[model samples]
Target: MEVKLHDIGEGMTEAEINCFLVKPGEAVKADDPLVEVQTDKMTAEIPAPRAGIIKEFTVQPGDTVSVGSTLLILEVGEQAGVPVKIEKNLPKPAVAELQAERLQSFAAVKRKRVLASPFTRKIARENGITIENVAGTGPAGRILDEDIYKFMAAAQQKPKLPAQPAPKEPAKRNDKVTSTIPLRGRRKQIAKKMVHSLNTIPHCTHFEEIDVTELITFRNELKDQNQTISATAFFLKALSICLKEFPVFNAELDEEKEAIHLLKDHHIGIAVDTEEGLIVPVIQNIEKKSIRDIHKEMKQLTDKALENMLTVKEITGGTFTISNVGPLGGSFGATPIIQHPQTALVSFHKTKKMPVVTEDDQIVIRSMMNISMSFDHRVADGATAVRFTNRFAELIQNPKMLVLEMV
Candidate 1:
């Protein structure tokens, strides 16, 4: 039986074969993981359909195969028919050619026995470096991505032929060699999305500063009660409320239908920065969830994202998006790119203590946080964006208002 690659989820068209878990002639029971494949989003293992001995692999590690492409052949009991004996009838020259071909195939297989993931191999291929030539420093002599980079750097530093005596002229600034990063995998995907968003949507960003002194105090009180909730949870709840009031920001423009479709459900996506790239995992139906529940779920999703273990469902169907770069220590503001098709995205920056003047002309220190909200100008105007954020600020400044709005 031929084992073919199938669509795992999210209409995946192609995937790179990471590695084979079982070797040729190895016996595997039903549902045993046969090979690992890496999609743009995550790495998954293709399992065996039934108990069978692995006959041969049609594809190799790091080879990108489309859906329905043959991955391997399996030899099930009795159905695999007996091997034909055609070699004995062949002429002398034909037999010699067949033997030589077998030897070459064996050598090729032996050379590819190095331990490495598909991503590591991709980096090596992009840099024109051979995986076998690079030394592995990982567990059980696995070739890591860093090893491939180190090999390239060392190769570049090798001494070349002696240069001719230079004149009094100095070298040009552009003559220096610089390292290049390969645009592949997740980074490539992000670039494509960003370009599409910029080209298709006219984005307008509005910046605001909110006094979070009372909110910080409220959080400290919660910590004393042994119930801790993140500030982002409160922000999400407040945003959901504002989205209900200003439905345009939570809508999608259907150019074909010449109308804007306002969504009733609030599925918010939190942008997480990982070593691979920015991954957003959705928190569905935020309007119905409490701040504590949102905080718990947000932590779980962020952990999964950092580990690159999020499923397709966890990353799709986002009505709105939020990026909290506060923990990363950027105190100012940034014009965050809106997730395509979603009307708006808000990014919260670092908070710091600043002086504030009260209504009674009293000066005091307060915790102030900056936020940048970017919305599709075609869908909503700047005034509407400002009003939406103003309501959000009001809810956040008074944490007690969130309790009355909770489900």
Candidate 2:
């Protein structure tokens, strides 16, 4: 039996092998964990298809394979036969021609007038155009390779009704190649998601500085009592309270249905920096948890993320996200991009001992910090986002309010 890499969920097309759980000549049972592979989104354990002996491994650790590519060969239900051989990569022309022939045969079976080779059909499918609408210019009015390319080029060209600016000439560069790295695994996934978020979401960032002298004092008191709490826990608690008051901050925009969904559960995603990349692990029902509880859970989540042991559920379903750059040190504030589907993100920077004016107008030193808020402008206007950040700042500035609520 052959075990081919299949869909690993989240529309992932490829995966890199992290490690093989079973060795060659080892026997494995049906539904048993076989290979552990890592995609850009998450790490997954691929299970064996049937009970069999591991005959050969076609891929190795750090090697990336396509979605339908063979991962390994297994001996099941009979003597282990020779491993199935994979064919060579075909030339572009031959591949397109063969694809077109297959499409032509399918069109004939369906009794349709569409006369496209596989490549042409693929182009139409990718561009979301109907093949039947494309007029053929080849023999017998059949669609040719050139015909598909011409149609695509024509469709992509902008109209000449309005005068357009002259395009800039292409820049010349050194032809010698330096290095090439395969965009695979987590890095590739991050690139795709970041690009999509930037293109689709209109982001508005608001930066504000708050005097957290009292907040710092409160946290130090807790530490004196042998109860450790993280600044992230404080931020999460403040944001959760703010969300309760402003439901719009906790809402998700449904562009397809032209609606906004206000989520009741306060699942706050804490962005943790890992060696591979940044991953956000959500803490569910944050509104119901105390600062201590939030701190403990955040520590566990961070450890799991660093070790790459976080589950899929742990990494998803964040109503809002908080990215704390304080630990990195020497940073004041940063405008972070909104994690897609989520309307807002809050970034925390390092605390510094800066001079401040006292309530009585006396100059004094205080533990002040800067926080950056980023929101999807489509869902929230500048005023709304400002109000939300102001409210969050108010909560942080008044540390006594949080202490009273916890009591």
Candidate 3:
């Protein structure tokens, strides 16, 4: 019996061959891991094609394969002469037509009436529009798109509406043909959650700065004891300590039925800057773990993040996320976007030396960092968010606070 591979996702057949765990002539049991495929959406490990001996193979490593595109021809052993049925989850005929229409053209006339979003259709109807202008506000200029007709109409109605900006589609750039990369993985989830958060929960950003000269000196002193400890690790330790006092920063916005619910767990997602992109892996049980434990976990998370084995679950779920780009480069000051549901995201920028007055009223150099706090105004008040940063600032400068709570 010949075995064929079918797609697991809707028309998403091709996948990057991550690795082949088995070689030809290898006897395998049912459900044994065989070909590892990295799809656009996910990585799947295709199992054995039945209780069979691999007769021949087709594709090799790093190959993109399509649905029904056989990876290998498996000759089923007589013991189980019946080949495993490959399941192809193609969309139904009508559904396929609808999807094709959606993918091909944004909106088209159907049954003497154009099938479009209510907004776009309304805009056309109101203006006595004879022609449907396919304006591609969407990526790739292909408008399977959303038409902001009300916004357009409202702006058009108001001549005083400050030089109604022309459509942004015709801008020319360097000889490069620009293309939009779809938001995938963490970026996709982040975009979705951000829209949901900003749309549902009101957001207000607060900015502040922290004088960390004392913290710098103390961190250097600790570096003498343990060279591996980073300023970022030290900051995480400090933030954890301060969070214990500021319980409101630990609360989450409950969108359903509208209420703010307090969660006791402080799972901190420390934003590690990997060569590929920024990833925030959670340091679980932050309140339970000591500073040393947090440091070790940060290192592990950083390493895994760079290596790309951290998994999807590792990249998500946190009451708050701390982005420590301070050590990498760029001087203090950045307003980071709040990482949704949590109501806050803290950005760490580079600390620069700036002149400041001391207790004795003399000018002195202090290491200053701009703490950009993006918080949901609905959940945390401007005063509360600023106060949280103020507390975080104090905790860092007071190095004693970091180690004091460690024991």
Candidate 4:
């Protein structure tokens, strides 16, 4: 049977093949990873539809295959039969030249000696670098273009003596070559999502500087008790509580249906930056989870994200998102883009000790953090967003609120 590229969601019609996990004659089980494909949203491993031995791959790595296009041929179960060739609709004459070039390039790539993909080899050629010299960092030590960039960066960063004279031969002298990296893989996916989110979603950002002096104090107390909880865990708890009052914040917009999806379950997505790119893995039912629960689950997801082991289930179904760059470094605040379909996204920066005025009108030093929320103007107005932020700030400012539920 021909294994065609099935519907990989988020309205993605085509995907660039990244790597094939199985080769011809390789034995595999149903749902086993057949190939990893890079879509506009994420790089996901397409699992096999049935247990079979791989017959052949119609598409190679770096080739762009559309939905319903033949991906591979597989012999499934006991009886093996030749795949029946189905007639496909002829493409327009305008695209014939482009398609021919793509096919020619793919065929030429098959004759290359380098282990790197055609795209990676193209980058190497553009930079006038030998593909054999560049070390591979990807699986099976396959040379990736990123490894080339890293190599270039390292070479440029090397200190040279000011008194050193230039070599007589033009080719002998070491000079830096500027290379242009074609945005592909995870970075390209992020770029598409960001552009779409910004263009489609009319974002309204509301910033708040919360005085978390008491919250910090309470967290420190918990740390002493060996019940270490991150500030993000507390924030999640507060945000989940606020979602109950502000359902719009936790909703999804279906512009096609001309309706709003007010989700009851608070499946909050936490944006995590990894070596590949930024990804949000949802923690299901945040409303029922306590501070400890959030902390534990967040850690597990974060570790998986960093390791590039997050499953499709973990990356989808987020009703809302939080981007906490606090641990990364110091930042005032960031207006994070809403994780579309979801109506809102919140950003939390590093907490710093700054001077603050109490209700008694006395100035004192307090632990402060800046929080920013970007919500869809269509689903929520400025006033609604402000109210939600204020309520969230109020919960975080008062340690007693979070302390009551601390495990």
CA RMSD of each candidate after superposition: 8.5, 19.4, 18.9, 11.4
Identify the leading candidate in terms of lDDT.
1
Candidate 1 per-residue lDDT, tens place, 1-407, comes to 89899998674788877677778966566676678776655666788887566789999986888999999998664322221223577998886676566445434443324666544655665565767798999888988767877787788843222122234445567776343455655665677679978998999999999999999999999999999999999999999999999999999999899899999999999999976678899999999998999999999999878656677789888999999999998898999998888999999999999999999999999999999999999999999989998999999999999888764
lDDT by candidate, in order shown: 0.81, 0.75, 0.62, 0.76
The stretch of ten residues in a row with the least summed lDDT in candidate 1 is: 157-166
lDDT of 3 at 119: 25
Candidate closer to the true structure by lDDT (higher is better), 2 or 4: 4
> For every model in order, what is the number of clashing pairs?
0, 4, 0, 0
Candidate 2 lDDT, 221-317, residue by residue in tens: 9899998787778888988888988889898999999999999999998888765677788899999998889989999988778656677788777
TM values, all candidates: 0.73, 0.70, 0.60, 0.72
Q: Give lDDT tens digits, candidate 3, residues 138-248.
A: 444423223434444545742122112244455576645444564443344346556766686566777787888887787678778875567777777777776777777
Model 2 residue 2 distance off true place after TM-score fit, in angstroms: 4.6
- Return the TM-score for candidate 1, rounded to 2 decimals: 0.73
Q: Please give the lDDT score for candidate 1.
A: 0.81
| lDDT comparison, 1 vs 2, better candidate | 1
